[model samples]
Target chain A: MLNVTEMLEEIKNSPYREIEICAPHTGRVNFAAIQQGSKVEGPHGLWKEKPGTLLCTLDRERNPKPIAAVEKGELCLLHSELEGCFVEAGTRLAVIRHLLTRDEVQAAILKKALHLFTAPERAKYYFVPEIDKKVRTSGSQSVTVKDGMELFIMSRMKREVPLVYTGPAGLIYAVYFTHTSNVDAEQPLIGVCPPDQLAAIQEVIMRVQTEWTEQG
Target chain B: MGKSNKESNVAPAGGLIDVSSHKVLVANRGEIAMRIMRACVKLGVAFTAIFTKEDTASGHVRLAKELGGEKNLYRVSSYHDANELMAVADDAECTAVHPGYGFFAEDFRFARRVSKRDRKLIFIGPSWKIIRELGDKINTKRLARSLNVPTVPGSDRPIYDEMEAERIARTVFDFQVQQGIKRPLVLVKASAGGGGMGIEEVYDIDNFRSVYRRIRNYAMRQFKDEGVLIEQRITDFNHLEVQIVSDRSGKNPVHFGTRNCSIQSTGLQKRLEVAPGFSPDEINYSFDARKVLDDIVHYSLTMARKVGYDNVGTWEWIVTHDGSPFLMEVNTRIQVENGVSARIASVKGEGGVDLLAEQIRIGLGEPLGYNQQDIAFNGVGIEYRLIAEDPDNRFTPWAGLIERFGWQEKPWLTMHTHVPTDVPYEIPTEFDPNLALAIVWGENIEQAKDRGRLFLDSLELKGCKKTGGELKSNVAFLRQKTAGILQF
Candidate 1:
């Protein structure tokens, strides 16, 4: 892996990204109560069943569906001009400048540090039924995989065939693909950390934990 | 290619009432929404349509836009939200709401709200009272039994006492024995539980106690209600339906014809449907097929008349291997396969019978100008539900952006779909990925089957998953089942 210090330094220079929240459907938007630079929190709870902060309500066909902030951030930009006016779906409503959390920063660094097993083709990939069920119940990190293992079942064109793992395998450090959506060709399916690399990965995470300061 | 949505046509006047002033809100999506809009336009009535964010590019949205009316289109959060529909109706100044199957179609509460709300709009169906009366399974079963109409051979009410439950189970078994049935199975299901939960099938009466206790215990734990329903589990039967159409008067109910929907998926969901339920003229059967069809239709009409069913509805039934027809349930709204029956039915020798248009006319308080003697049937019609699914994988739904969908136009073929051909469409995962419905008509069963196969063969559907593989459809499965259409 590349030097973790340089990666951490680069991230330190810019530790935030502005994410735009758009109307999920066509509706008259009401952002009267929202103000710029206000703080927001994403869905949080043991199960994440508790919703995030309400940013605005998009009223259409008599139903007003509230758009919630999905990421913890400061409301840096709000489209106040479009308030009370009918807006089409995907219309820019607000933007949040979300600061990098400790987990996020570590995840960013680990993405480059981990040996990513990418999808060979654009198709729905699943960890062959047993592994899938295990991965669902327990986190993907609990499952260990080996090289040349029959891991995934790549479903395509109504046909299912076993997909053999080729790369040096280990504990799945991170699951990069969801079962519901399609994973693009060459997109990483899972980030694997071999037994030898586990210590190095831990050290990098520890170093970031100590040096990085989280912002409110 | 089919007629574009932008194509303007003059609406023809039908029935005795001039319902031109009414504006209908099509509170649904997909092909059903498209059909409702077409019906409204056909009757010269203004209609409004709604689409969710996922349905931005759907044909229904395009049709509503091109249909040309003030505030005719609106995007809602969900199709299930009744408030949104009512609000849209009020905003659009619509006088009626047509719940085009699914969503709020069969919901009596939604229908009641539509009628009872301050700014009331006609719930373009049977009145809420009638919907509530027929919507309840227990009420329907009891009513059918009271009328001497054949319902399932089982308890109309839930059995609470174990002795009573066992006694009913014994009667069911003895009844099957009296009917000379072999290997009769008794179904023990939690009255409070549905969707196949807490349900057990007992092949032998000796072991029913163990199964009953397990079900009762499971029900008490799961639903907190130990009540159970005992019914004779029917096997080797054909699922049939009678298309009933009546006016607001709730009287003079007449049937279009019988439709056989026995062909289904592994989950027992209907896949292929045929009008004129059976062909006694062509196929030989152990029982009188013609008499069975007539009996079911007559029973359906009798029930429809009893309830004052004031709109288009379907009476679902199952004909056993020995030809005993039992009423399953009553669908209080127009069905997805309504067109199949309409394809073969003619009112007063008029070949084209648009049932939705008739429904709207009747819903607006206009009586059905014709009676049972006027309605006639002439050909075999088949309806194929085209969907993006893997038949080999337990009908697993496939979600992907549909890139291309096309089919050749035939003289006897009518295809209904909300999927636009000119542009790619992302399949909305929130709802069932139903692509289209192809209704093919033929002079006879042999011809109908041939046409169905030809239609499926000529149909071209191409799509790819977001990640990169080709989309899977049930076309091959539908094609294979074409030969077995209406075969008992």
Candidate 2:
């Protein structure tokens, strides 16, 4: 069993504790050129109303990752505005919406409110071990990398992320984890992990599964 | 009255029809009803479209109004309500009634009721006596035996208990031993129904009681009869059937063509039907299939002639693993998949009319099979009967007005039927949950199956949650298992 009073006390104490998640694929603006201070609405440029910056990451597998500035904000595009921006898997990103005020979120209510809380401001940060110091300007550098690799990278930086996308064509597994009791009480939980990603997602699942199995 | 209202008021009523005129009331729904209604129109006779609340919106009713005018199209409570149907026919002054292969199509009581109410309501099919007689497995088996058609060893009557099923299985084993059969399996089959009703294949003797009891309960609920017939299970068998047409003048039996319904789940209801025969490879695998069909047809015709079979019917024959044929059953009226026969018939220069249309045409003394020998496959006609059900709930029938019916056209196929707007259909709990059939006519079995697969993908029927999509997947699985190529 969980002590509602202790869980509530912990939630109160940590109400404003900040958690940062870096979304690596959110800020690469492709095909962009800077005219000192001139305003231009090219494919790679940020919207005229709001100016933003981009960060890039390079992977060893010949695929470059771009993190756009828009990834730091809430998903605010109309349904039809976002057309074809794609994010590959394993790109580190964090969602940091302010879920609840210090007075609102209690452990007793948290059990029934997974979807009710607001998400945090999601910010993306990219990492490339080799290109930690590399920076690119329009039209110069990386011409030999590919025909228009810089341009391609710039154009994608500001594009809105598609909420839904197709996964790579291969096997997929759906894992479910059920929490059987409150977190403070160290109660049982039920966890499920797909066979392929058993090792990766298994730790979280086993704890939950053990709780649920024991509770039953 | 305005022209439209005038037209609506002027229901197609021929001049004062005599009491004995050969006016026909079609007792069915959908394309079959429309098809039979056409026959009445062609004969220059009055046609009455007896419909349920659901069938009011159907194409058949509209066609009746077109042919016989507005007055000819009437409504009924239910097709199976024999007394109400008879009263409607009498009120319409119809001389005959055609049961179009569903609802009351195979029902003996409906036919008998109509006949009793109006002696001249000439039920345009096999007699009620024949429907009842051939309906019973025991009697049909005996008839098959008399015609020299081989039958699985079993009793001629419905079994009452587990002991009877075991006893029959033992007898079948002994009979198989005498015939040199090894490890023979027995099937407990219902005596008085078709379409794989209450047929359970039992391998172990211990499983016999449960299988028997299950089928017994199912048969009792379905046919109002719990009697069962036991037969030797013919494994690795190819199902073949002959379409025989006969009438009052004499038994005019002819083999339209043979179709192999072998692509099905063993010991269960038939799922897929491919007509005009399967590939040569299938035939080669079962060497005696063709000869077996010939024998079965010969014997079926003989039995029909002896028993005074009228109009059109089908004789079901199954070929054993050792290339021998046995009489499985007989259907006394139109079949759900008779579109295959019509498709082949049309390519040979005959009119593209289905079995119900053929029955009407034949009954009216129309010439049939003018070029029977020349008739060949136009292509393969594939059909999937849609059953309304929740997919997650093991596909139980969900009854209601279909909310959506959708289609996407392709160049290779043609859809022969259209939904009528007047019929308000609900899934009746009393009957099989199948709502409608989706048919695809293609150039070959492969092409047809391919079109069937695509057609299922594009089809959308609103109102009821349907299993056509699921069945489409099942059909693909079956085709793959049977090594049938469905190139799309």
Candidate 3:
């Protein structure tokens, strides 16, 4: 059994340039590493040297890169907070930059998931605009609509912005845009529109990015 | 853009090669085709029946042969071109053609082609020019505006995008507010289509985009044109229409009073109709709206005379709570549920159907003896559209043979859309959603409704349960909705 905070602290100090987390069959969240440049060693020494890594952008054509290799099986953690959660035991939680020392690489991974169990949450869902097309795509395709295409709220409210989704291709993008509200603590609040109108009806999703600001 | 390449071709005028000898051909199908065929029989003219492939076994086609000589029957393709239908008339060695409603009824191009290329076939019903004029929604709206006939408020042009949709919605919302109309709703509708097709309602802004997209797809699919218009959604309204007939001879036009078709499906799909909308005072029902009918006839006649809509057509209107009548769209051909009007037109003589005889006479330039002053009613008439679908399943359309058919027939329960047995029948998907309807007339509205319920309950269709329960359920729902039973 591993301590959640200590593991997160070790991973934060590690040297991964990009990080992604997923609760399989549920959802995936990703973030780019902020480390400018770092190098790390591998178990196989001089004969097989790994390249140093930086927070460089991947080509537009590629999907996000993965860092951890979580086995496709259930996991159990002793911590009360991670009771129902699954994290691979002894998993190499971080992939370091070729330039960083093993110690630094481990530290970066720890910092990233410092509040792993208590972190605020957000959700995104993809829905098929029409039944036939979605079936054809098989939920693994991507459609490219030009940016600023006008997303609408379930109510008549609309804003011109493209909805980007790394989910099912034929489905329109809908997300339970979760955020911390002043009114509630423990539970994250989300904004969502009506279901029937979630499909290719409107282009951009009118998300409340800054509720504290008054535009009018 | 290129002047449409469409022109109304006029027939070569003369006493139809030989009025007594020339055969009349009806290049159509269904009850309307039968209606026209009956008119031909009265003229003492040898008749020809041209049927589509699907209608070869139709009761109408079969009945046509039983009434007319066997030599008059001819078969054509169901999906064949309209010109092919006209050619069927020519092949049958016929002198005239009557395009029954549905296929080529409002097809001005086909009408012109029949009158021009064929030269001999007299095009019955509206002149091709009138069909061209009123067949278009935008042009008709313009004409209505010019005639001071009130129509639903909305943009006069096709709404192409969301901004325009929102703009129109905002304007209409504002107008509704200014007019003191509470909780006003709006509708996005396709201009070219009719019969409740390609119309969607938007209750609030959030749903507008979704509704607009659906409506756009439907409009494009149905009319093959994505020209959609937005209008204020009218609620708690009564659908009323006056049947008007005009002829080229043009002495005084006839108004067959008003029929109330208030009971309707919420959307632009098939609607169930009830006639002689319930009124406590028969003489003074919808008085202001009745005056509006007079104005509507005047306007419709002006437009009809200009375009030349002879034969049967309806000047449709709707009455709101303020006791004001607003002009709805005009139906160029006889309405499908117009069996009520058919019965009203029918005069029981010692020998034959009186109205049927009179309609034929009017076609050939003769007087219809019954005047406005002579018009009187025996009872109330109610007509219900029997859609071939399962009601519990959102009315998904059903197509198959009607194996068994029986209805509660009372003295006043005159069932039209006569699917005569003694022959096989195949109901097709090409036309209306409604396969058939049972029209019942009574001493009053309640009696008519009771007879309607009886006819609906008694209707036994075996091939598929034609939702007699759903129809009865819907009628009950409507009665409650209109507060017909609950009204003080």
Candidate 4:
């Protein structure tokens, strides 16, 4: 039921997302020396121990704090006018255009092909305690979720209520929300893969890994 | 000039200390910072405030901009950075620094740097020497024992020798047994280790040796110190603290009575505090609550006088269900529950006494102007820590946008908060999730509890997360606990 070639073709046509960097608080902004079209790398290395490229520094109360890029991208525009000037919080400092990598493209295609389990209500979502421990120690892909299984703890108004899964039994292929984050009602919380679709999912991954190329 | 100044205001024995020319840098954030700034204004002294990026929309920043006017508020990167605070102080030309409750409040190094730097700034607290001396737990115990003030019966020094350690343990057990304690517990822990590491509790005296040996060996391997401490584990005691205020000349010190802060979260964080420490007339306590309160106050003042404790501090104590009281430790900084004590306090014939104003007045090189006879206590005051947290889930902090937050204003209720009600505010995750401190007062304990319940019922706190889920608060929990306040 999934068309891998068509999904890859659709992503190849337009494979970029624009990200705007905003000031986290009121401060004097100073743009790190960067030119338009300059390449920037996001955080990398195992455990993300290495920081990404420095975009600028926000100086407040004689203390300078570094702001780094969150995604690998090309510098599109810099708000140089804000340099050396005091700016309020939420001020847009820069715009970056990032090219979608093979991993991201694979993720985009998989989201469409997999059976997505959605949140029933707009609340903070977390895996139930026992499943949470398992998911944390192992990966989400190793955990199988089934219909009527208590899979989540929906937290709202300081109270926690258990949420039961209602989809086909399958491995949790993707997790859309972290324990600290909130999810909207009817939004996908996890993408599940049925037992028979394992071959198709593996084929999609194999094709993307072998055929997809990174754009310069 | 001395004669005229003495006639104008009650000057100390020396003369009136003119601190009108001084400016203070409030080195903190949120409620305490706002309190300090307001105190500075009341004392006719200029003050500067600092806030990090996330706290830009905090009520303190708005208050600073309104009252302090232009160039008085600085945006800081972090509240924990001393260099940033000092640099701001210098840039703002502030004459002194006020380390409110946290951050640099208890750090002697920061206090020392504030005084010892080339361009010195007065640290609005005890001198660095006093802070250093009392900051050490062992030193504080030794000081208390030296003055014959009652401390928890334990070995004050590290027990390096097995024989001496066993002797101290035997004495602790025998003392507990004499006190009619059932199944006495002994705590053995590595002296150099902290945060519950290298610690064990022995319920049976026969198990003490094995636990001690294990902890000592672990301490030697992990902390590189074979030293261990042996003490009787105390539990089921009500927590109490005495508020001590003095001038730079620690000679004439006074107390603002005591407060009961035993109702705490599972993590030992205080949630509710009641003034006067105990309610003997209203609630029939197992002990002589009135005498216990007086004893703690007396012992606390004694230690304050002995150590020349100059500035605002708290002497923490714990009273067993029986009448025995034990000095726990000293917080050499102004505490969060200071307002509850102030609420029940009055000066001379005037009912409204501002202890923060008093602290700033004396902290900025001024005299106390009054003594014990001028101070008096009236009424029962209860302070509820209104926070966005789950009471059923170990008080886990809830973070989200507070769309609406307010309560009915009453004559007896004093609310202190940094959350802005006029605008939708996002709770900052870096700090405590405390929304406000609502202190309600009454003529007696029953009325105070009644008003506390009424206040909680009147409170309107509504919010939501990024997910459309509603905000969670301890308002109901607070309402339910209102009846049991200050009870044994």
True contacts kept of each: 0.20, 0.00, 0.00, 0.07
Measured with C-alpha atoms, the lDDT of residue A213 in candidate 1 is 87
Judged by DockQ cut-offs, is candidate 2 incorrect, acceptable, medium or high? incorrect
Give a tens-digit lDDT track for model 4, residues A1-216.
788888888878888899998876556788888866788988889988788788999886556978888889988988888888776556788888999988898898889878999987656787876898898899998899889999987765433567899989999999999765557667999999999899999998999998799765
Whole-model lDDT, model 3: 0.51
lDDT of 2 by residue, A172-200 (tens): 12201111111211121111122443353
Candidate 3 chain B lDDT trough over 10 residues, lowest sum: B1-10
The deviation in Å at residue A84 for candidate 2 is 73
lDDT of 3 by residue, B383-429 (tens): 66665554444444444456666665577766556465433344553
Q: Candidates 2 and 4: which is better by lDDT?
A: 4
Cα lDDT tens digits, model 1, B1-488, are: 01112211212233244577789999999899998898888778888888887688889888888884536888776787676677667767889999988778877899999888888899998898888888776799989999999888788777789899899999999999998888989989887664335677899999999989877866775567898989999999999999999878776898989999998876567889999899999899889999999899889999998888899999999898989999988888999999999999887787888888888877876667778888889989999999898899878778788999999999999999999988899887556678999999999999999989999999889999866678999999999988887777
* TM-score of candidate 2 to 2 decimals: 0.58
Model 1 C-alpha lDDT per residue in residues A71-176, reported as the tens digit of each score: 8999999999997887755778999999888999998888999999998755677787689889889988899998889999875532345798878869999988
TM-score of each: 0.79, 0.58, 0.60, 0.75
Q: How well is candidate 4 docked (DockQ)?
A: 0.10
How well does candidate 2 match the true structure, expressed as C-alpha RMSD?
Answer: 23.7
Q: What C-alpha lDDT, on a 0 to 100 scale, does residue B113 get in candidate 2?
A: 68
Q: Per-residue lDDT tens digits of candidate 2, residues B402-446?
A: 545557866544444435433444333334445455556666565
DockQ of each: 0.17, 0.01, 0.01, 0.10
Off by over 4 Å in 3: A1-216, B1-22, B69-71, B118-120, B159-166, B268-309, B345-376, B418-426, B429-433, B465-488
lDDT of 4: 0.83
Predictions in order: lDDT: 0.84, 0.52, 0.51, 0.83
